[model samples]
Target: MDTLLSSIEMLARWDVMAALFIGSIGGVLVGAMPGVGAAVAIAIVLPVTFALEPIVGLTALLGIYGSSMFGGAIPAILVNTPGTPVNALTTYDGYPMTQRGEARRALSLAYSASFYGAVFSIVALMLLAPFLAKVAPMFGAREIFLAALLGIVLVIVTHRGQVLPAAILACLGIFLQTIGIESTAYTQRFTFGQPWLQSGVDLIVVVLGLFAISQALVLLMGRDKANDLPPVAKIGFFSQMKDLWLYRRVATVASSFGVICGMIPGVGEFMSQFMSYAYAQRSSKTPELFGKGNPEGIVASEAANNSVPAAAMIPLLALGIPGEELTAMMLAVFYVHNVIPGPQLFTQHMDFIYALYLCLFLLNVIVVAFLFFATRTLMKVMLIPNRFLGIMILTFSLIGVYTLRNSMTDVAIASAFGFFGFILKRLDLPTSPIILGIVLGKLMEDRLRTAMARVREPLDFIDRPIAFILFLMIVLAIAGQVWTVVKSRPNRKGTSHD
Candidate 1:
């Protein structure tokens, strides 16, 4: 109660209120714009968070993270373009609905589904967080090291079709992070002789380059096309709200998938949304209608994706491990503010946790309300030229990187990464694993080194029961990946013979 009261006092400030308002609305705007993903938007602003008060800065970022998906559906439903990468699944059902003149209903259903997901994940976080705090400390350095290994392994295998590319990129990220002088031995591994390399790579600079700058290049290089908005009908919000109960089963299941994926390191909205959509399709009596404007499809995708932002924080806040790329960036903000997340955070900063939960809950409601009333206005945002938006994002990226240290070297580094990011996009490879590798690489190294001081044997790393279980899970995951590849060989061989 005291913590809640303290948080309430802290949140009453005007700057916090402004942060919530601007971040939510801005998130929606950027999300509505095609090719401008939430990750890019967050990356552009990550440097600015360093200068603001911790609470104020965090609240603003949280607001953006929480609401962007709601805006993401706008372009998906109307323009058949996904505003954010994760909204790609939403396009399968949303765009078809728009073409059939049910645009309003599709948007409404998407929003309602998002609400169901957002609320469920928030409640789960509230209920599970304290319990997580209690359990976080039971695992030691070896367990954490194993957990980080599991995260890296999961990042590779979860790419499904692009497993090899993801592994290579993850290794590249780990290697990049190891470039500077060693934290323990003080010996440089990859610097070669450059003064800039001595300090190693900056996470923000890398993020700005790979995501923000690279995305800008893609946008600028690509020609923009104008899109026509489908006409929307007037629909009562309350009527649409009541219609959601019919999908409670699917909504509940999808939301559960979101929370579960959000909690596990490396499994993100992509997995949750895909699994939910697949399940919904498999279970529906009218499965044929799934890709053809099915309301259930919208629910499955939106609910699961929206649930992720809050649930992804579970591992971040409880264990200091990021569940996805976005959370990895958010972890940077936590570090900048000197607000470390983990078990000790609960005992030391319970108020911040409670406040953050409340803030997410309210921001969600505000986003739904704002998006509901501004539906007509938002569809118009889709017509803005992608090239112009790309230029603006590039400008923002350069400025943000420059301000970090007022250094030209950082700007150049970011530009190089930007080109790399563009190449990844061109080659159709995942960029997220690299970020994960960078963030988790440092973590795994530190934990492993700490654990090795006492235990040197390979088998000794899994002596703890929890560590053993995690190691087993990692083994099973690898075996499963191999089996999947091996099992597909027979089909290919038989087809060749035929």
Candidate 2:
């Protein structure tokens, strides 16, 4: 009751409302552009938040977090490019819908799903977070270690078809995590005395290089000429609303999947969308229609991706652990304001947190309202030339990386990752596993060290119930991969025989 009242009070403030509107609009615009994500948009805006109240600052950040999902679908539908990595799944069906002259329907589905997912997840976060926060402190080093293991296991299972490559990338990411100084021992693991390397690689730099710069390079490699986009068809707002109503169950299921996946640390929008798409494919009556202008695919992907921003906030708000790169950046913002996240945060700053929830809800409303009025204008941006789009992406990529710490070394690091990303792309290697590994590596290392120090026998550490469960998951993942490989070998052999 008190929390709701406090949220209402915060919403009544003029500055808060203004911040929400501006932030939502900015987030939508930034998210709409290919290769730019909420993280880059928020990082660019973080410094400006230094002047605002805590609630206001968070309102702006949350607005960006929520609306960017919708923004990502813009390029996905129009240009066969995803504005964000999370939106990559959307491209499979969204672009196809556009190619069939259903751009407006695709856009409409994306906006509706994004709005519902964001709103639903925010409601879930508001209701579940406080209870989750109460339980978080009970998690010891062993449980955390198990949790980290489970996260990595899910990554492997989710990318099962390419387990070896994913494992290799994950190990490489873990290796990157060990590059900085060891916190407990005060010893550098892989710094090699270079001052810049001491900080290791920024996750943001790696993500931008892999998703943005590498994508640009791939785009440039494909052709010097650009493909023409289909003309935008007029779509009635009421008609779109009816279409969304028809697929409410699909959106709800996808949003639920997203919320669950988002709650798990390290797995974010990418896995959520993929999982949801798999589920949708299995459940849909017209499974063949998927990847061929299926509206359900757009609903599943968009809902899941949008839901992640809110769901990812769960661990951040409750346990002080960010689930992905964007939330990690948001965590820094909370630190800047001296509002440390975790159990103490809810009790100490309940008003602000509630206000943030309200802002998230309102931001969704704002985005939907804007999309309702300006869908045509926004869709036109999709028709912009590929070369011009590439230039803009490159410019933002440079700016976003430079803004990380205002360091030239960071830019060089980004370029280096760009080259590596290009190589991985050519080899058809998944970059997501590398990201998962990099983010989870340090956490895993820290927990392993702590558990080893406490256990009399090293093997005893794995005997814990949670650890055992994680071990089983790892076994299952490996077994699954082996089975897939064995099955493929026979197919190749039969082809040779034929």
- The sequence of per-residue lDDT tens digits that candidate 2 reaches over residues 323-435 is 65567656656766787666567666677777777788888888988887786677655555556656666677777778768888888888788778878889987876677
The residue pairs that clash in candidate 2, if any, are: none
lDDT by residue for model 1 (1-498), tens:
788799898899999988888888888888988888889989988898889888788888888898899999988988898988889999999999988889999999999999899999999888886787678877678887777788889989998899999999999988888988998889987888988999899999999999999899988999988898878765566789877898999999999999999888888899999999999999998999999999999999999999998888877887677877888898998888788777778767888888888889988988988887888988888888889989899999999999999999999999999999999999999998899899889888888888998886878888889899999999999999999998876654446533
Worst 10 residues of 1 by lDDT: 489-498
Residue 146, model 1, lDDT: 79
Clashes of each: 0, 0
- Which candidate should be chosen as best, given lDDT against the real structure? 1
- lDDT values of the candidates? 0.89, 0.76
